[model samples]
Target: MKTRAAVMLAPGEDWKVAEIDLAPPRFGEVLVEFTHAGLCFSDEHLRHGGLGDLPAVGGHEGAGIIREIGEGVTGLAVGDHVAASFIPTCGRCDWCVSGHSNLCASAANSPGSADPDTFRFSLDGNTIPANCGLGTFARHSVVSAKTVIKVDPEIPLDVVAVVSCGVLTGWGAAVHAAEVRVGDTVVVVGAGGVGINAAQGARFAGAAHIVMVDVNPAKLEFAKRFGSTAEFDSPAKAAEYLWSVNPVAGGADVVIVCTGNTTQAVVTSAYEMLGTRGRLVLAGMSQDVFEPNVHLPGTQIVFREQTIRGTIYGSCNPRHEVPIILDLYRQGRINLDELVSATYRLDDINDGFADLRAGKNLRGVVAHG
Candidate 1:
């Protein structure tokens, strides 16, 4: 099959929207006809030379229906409504067995699984990679069936697609990854797609106060609708406010950083804004050389006992969490529609990333054929 997709040819390059051929689904694979795709900042990283290796199709957050199922595939059939998980959870990996399916072993080879070590998409058989392997930028894509999850039919395609990454990442960071609780004060850095969800998840989890930090005015505004009790334009203010909230306002119980900025200074600041025994979760990615400089001072940690952890895809299980998160959306407990601040056609895809970087949209969706 041939597909029209936005191809990111290399690092520091713009995406090329063109027609390419798609291959048939192989073993344990499914082909989806996507109606909606979410433009994510992580994909933006690919455009700006992140982690190198490119000439790929990009679109991990997509909503569509199964059009075909490959050999050895069962439990998923054609015409089933599904949200395509960009990261495939093999269900057999050690992490999957432990309920942390996002770190599936299959995820490491997601880019290579399409077979021929090439791509279903090619101009003259030239290889093209898919961002997370479920390239929904194209009208249709053949993806690993293990990465696809059936979703509620009542949910809108745009709503489901955005949550496939942004919403789920943010929400899961607070719920599953951070395990937020009642009366706990949480601070979310970035205030964009992932950060806003963390704010909302903290609120839904009964947080006493939700503080959102972002440099962008627009993004800070978007975070407000998602249960952010307070907003800060800088981390300095976030730290100051953390101490100023109340006399008992020791510090933040949890801090989830989604900015993906690889600055040691930023990481250090995020780590410092915590109370005794506070948990700090790093949801952001640092540059290749950007290992954080963290001081686990015996006096600070032994007495306060701060725990620092890293989160991968919000520690989510798509098959288990997608529907659960969707139910919350349906019940109006979680704000899905608010997360979608803008939409684009597949042709205007690059503009979607522009909005994300400008912090103009909490999340952007691509309307596909």
Candidate 2:
């Protein structure tokens, strides 16, 4: 089958909409007709050469329906609604069984072709890898069963799409990784798509103070609707506010970093906002993979008993958390509708990303036709 998709042909290039050939799903895979795909910064990272093999179809966060099931597939059927998980989970893996599906062993080889010699998507007879092994940028994608989670059909696909990645990652970073407790003081840096949810998560966890820090004034202001009790333009100002309110600790109980691009400087600033026995959660992706971006004083950490931890997919199992998140959405506990600041047609994906770069949106979605 031939499907229209947004393809990133090279690094530092705009996404190009092209007609590509898609093969039928093989055993243990399924054909998904994607309805919506979120414009996550991770894909922006891919556009700038941060993730996955090149010449790939872009997009990792999406929601769709199973149009066809391949051989040996069970527990899902045609017409079932689902969301894509960028990190594939093999339930038998040690991490998955231990409630850490985000760290599933299969993730090491993710977003790559199932068969190295053959590809699921191709153009002009040249093979193309799907970003995160489930290129929801395309109208239809053949993805491994492991990269998708079943969702209730009543939920809107666009809402489910954002939760699939940004919402899940941010919420879990605060609730699971940071272990936000009642009356805790929390700080979330970078008030973008993911960071906003971190603020909401902190509020849901009963944090007394949920402060948002971002360079963009608009983003900082926008975060208030999502449960940010206060906003600041820089970590220093936020730190100052924390000190004034909680002078004894001189910082927050938990600080979550959700910047579009993580940096050594950002990590250091986030760490400075942590008080005694505080936890610093790094949920952002650094541009340089090999760079040692974290530089913190070991003695201070030892004396203060502070912790610095990194999380992928917020350290929450997709299959387990996706449903709970959707349930929260259903009950009006989480704000999914307001999270989508804009929506675009697939052909306008490049423009959508441009808006992302300009900080014009909290989260953007591509409505696949």
Candidate 3:
């Protein structure tokens, strides 16, 4: 089948719309007719050569319908509504069996050549790579069966496609990874899709204070609607303001670093903002991993119990959190529409990323076939 897709031809370049040929499922794979694809920052990493990959089809978070199934696939049939999972969790893997499907070994393997199996997608009579193995940027894709997560019919496919990644990543970071608690304080370092979700998760977890820090003022306010107690572009300024309001625990209880591009200045500042026993979670680290400040804050970790963590897809199990979060949205508990500040058709995928990089939107969408 011929599918319309956007390809990142080179680093620091815009994606070009290309009509590519895609093959059907070979085995243990399923073909999804995508209806929507999300614009995530990680793709920006690829565009800048930070991810160190090339000639890759960029699309991780998306929603579509299962159109075909391979011979070995079961429990899912054609016409099933599904949101593409970035990670394909092999049920038998140690991580999956241990209730950590998010880290399934299969998810870390390369696409186009599924180590234990052959891929089903081909472009221009040749193989084309899928991001995280489920490239939803195209009109069609052949992915590992384990990566397809079912969604409710009531939810719009466009919304579900984007949320499964951006929303889940942020929310899961706060709720699952950080395990934020009621009356706690949280500092979200970016107010983009993932960071906004983190802000909301902290709110849902009943965090007493949720301070959002972002370079864009618009993102800060946008994040506020989702439940940010305060918004600031400067962490130091924000912390000072927080101290003014409550000086006793001047530092944040939990600091989520969503801004991937960390400079030397912010690196030290981020760590300095955390209080004793405070946790700092790196939600989106830069493509160019910078040196972290290991200088201790007076042995705070040992004396005060501080912790640092890197969160992947917010440490969420797709099968577990996708439905759970959708229900939260259905009950009017989460603000999804607010996150989608702009959207473009599949052909205009590049434009979507442009808006994301310009900091002009909280989130952008690429509607598929």
Candidate 4:
């Protein structure tokens, strides 16, 4: 069958919405009719050759309904609403069995198709890899069941879509990775889609002060709605402010870097904001792989006992954490509705991303028919 999708043909090129051929689901896979796709900065990484190869379908964060289940698929059926997990889990893998499905071995092949030897999408008879193996940019996709979690139909699919990646990643970075405790002072750098949730997560974890650091004035103001106790234009200013208020500790207990483009400068600034024994969690993606992004002093880290850690998928197990995140949204503990600053049709995806680049949106959603 043919479906419309946004395809990235080469680096530094705009996404082209074109009709592509999609194959049916194979064993352990299902056909999904996407309802909403979240415009995440990680996808923007693909546009600049930061991750994944060219001639790929874009979109890793999305929620949809299962149109058909392939042979051997269980616990899901047609009409079931589900959210995509960028990291597909093979339950038998060591990481998955040990409660760390985010590091599942299957993710090693995420840049290509679910099966290393096959391609599920094609255009003009040429193979087109789906970004992260589950291309939600397309109207319909055939994805391995392991990469989707059945979601409650009552919850909005748009909310479900963002929760699958940004919300879960940010929330887990604080609650799980950083192990935020009550009364702790936390600083989150970058108030974009991911950073805002880190602030929300800190609040949820009972942090007394959740400081959001970002240059975008609009995002700084918007951060307050999700639980930011204060906002600053830069990490240096945030660090200065944190030292004044958190006199005893001298700085924040935790610092989470959620900038869209992680750089060595950002890492150094985030590290400088840490208090004694503070934890700095790197949840952002660094585009430059050739140079080291981290340049912390080993002596200070050893003496202060500060920890610098990196997380993928926010150190969350998609099947377990995704449901809990949705529940948090359902109980009003987390605000999923306000996270979406704007929405657009699939055809207007480029405009949505342009708004993201211009810092005009907290999070953009593509509302599919």
Q: Which of the numbered candidates is closest to the native, going by highest lDDT?
A: 2
Per-candidate local distance difference test: 0.80, 0.91, 0.79, 0.90
**What is the clash count for each candidate, in the order shown?**
3, 0, 0, 0
Q: How would the candidate models be sorted by lDDT, starting from the highest?
A: 2, 4, 1, 3
Candidate 1 C-alpha lDDT tens digits along 1-369? 788999888777777899998888888888899999988877776666554357778878889999998999989889999998877878887988998888887773332344446356675587666767778898998888887898877789999898788888888899878899998989998888888888888898999889988888877777778899999898788888888773363788898888856466767778778877788888877644235545445577667777888787788888888899899888878888877778898888878887776767777888986
Tell me the lDDT of model 4 at 316: 91
What lDDT would candidate 1 get against the real structure?
A: 0.80
Summing lDDT over every window of 10 consecutive residues in candidate 1, give the lowest-scoring window. Answer: 109-118
What does candidate 2's lDDT look like per residue over 179-266, in tens digits? 9999999999989989999998999999999999998998988898999999999888899999987677789999999998899999
* lDDT of model 1 at position 256: 89
> How does each model score on TM-score?
0.93, 0.97, 0.93, 0.97
RMSD in Å for all candidates: 2.3, 1.4, 2.3, 1.4
Clashes of 2: 0
Worst 10 residues of 2 by lDDT: 108-117
Tens digit of per-residue lDDT, candidate 3, span 1-369: 877788777778888788887877887888888888888888887677656345667888899999888989988889899988888767898989998888888774332233423444565565656777777788888888888987887799878987779998899899988889988888888788888899989999999999988878877777768998888888878878766654566688888877756555655677777876788887876655444633445566777688887778889888888998898889999988767788888777777777887998778888765
Cα lDDT tens digits, model 4, 171-259, are 98999899999999999999999998998889999999999999999899999999999999987888889998788778889999999
lDDT over C-alpha atoms for residue 83 of model 3 = 86
